[model samples]
Target: MSLDYLVAQPVLEAERFILRPVRKSDTGLISHYASDERVARMTTSIAHPLPPGAVDAFVARAMAEDRSEDVWVIDGTREGGAELKGIIGLKRMDRNQSEVGYWVAPPFWNTGLASDALQLLVGSNPLKNDTMFASVFQDNPASARVLTHCGFKYLGDAESFSVARDATVPTWTYSRKL
Candidate 1:
């Protein structure tokens, strides 16, 4: 289903930042952060050494009329923070379900930015989903803590391909009922 007409992306507020829809002007900062190996390797999609035009294509997809996912940038400029702290998104699924994904720039790591962003998104529940699912690579316990700290229950273990790692990585899945 196309969310372009069904659901309007909302700007969600948080104490430290706001979760706003991605825009064309965000490409440069996003590229700068996602290009970092430390950031890219942690995500399932972002390829390490981020190729040219990769971020532009990503922004295009986020703004597409028929997009399957709703992406938001963690903007902190409202409080004189970095304009682009990172990204958080929800990939639509059937049965009023959606999968959550997020990343924080290396500089923003350990600052509770990811946790705050995830909490804001979950609290907002923009898609009005019945349930929201999330997973983090087992190697990244910090992200797992972010989910659990936000009240997500551990579901089980799984594996997902990491483009940056170029291999299947073990993941811990978690879910929360909205």
Candidate 2:
């Protein structure tokens, strides 16, 4: 499943959630979850104490055709669940590859939501990537477990700047050959 079509935007379904393109209405929910200090610090981009309109800008960017990444809302409402449990995305990289990124709200932590979402995404191989890459802060062992449980092998150590932390954090990189 070459994700080339995703450039046109498509809805992907998982067992418990609907992964769809971001929507304007999601701003409030997104802002609410993203503003959590724990959530923001875990991500590369979101800042702690989220700025005004940050979610708005993010939604706008996700909806843009020229954007480098394809983002989706982890909508679980159809299952009688939260409207927004989290977010997942893929950033296009060179050589038929992409980087996977995701975060689940604190309420959903340890509930296997991340594992399910990631397994669904990787198993689908929507991007038709020969390989996929991911990284998690060393402090976030659960995230590292999510990748490993999905069969991603440890690649090495790396460092990435966390805007919310306002510092460089050690990361454990992983990759899978699809």
Which candidate should be chosen as best, given TM-score against the real structure? 1
RMSD of each: 2.4, 2.9
Query: How well is each residue in 23-125 modelled by candidate 1, as lDDT tens digits?
Result: 8899999999999988888899999989999999999999887789999999999999999999999999999999999999988899988989999999999
Alpha-carbon lDDT, every model:
0.93, 0.90
lDDT of 2: 0.90
Error of 1 at 96 (Å): 0.3
User: Model 2, residue 18: what's the lDDT?
Assistant: 83
Error of 2 at 141 (Å): 0.1
**Model 1 worst lDDT run, 10 consecutive residues:** 1-10
- Against the true structure, candidate 1 reaches a TM-score of 0.95
Let me know the TM-score candidate 2 reaches against the reference structure.
0.94
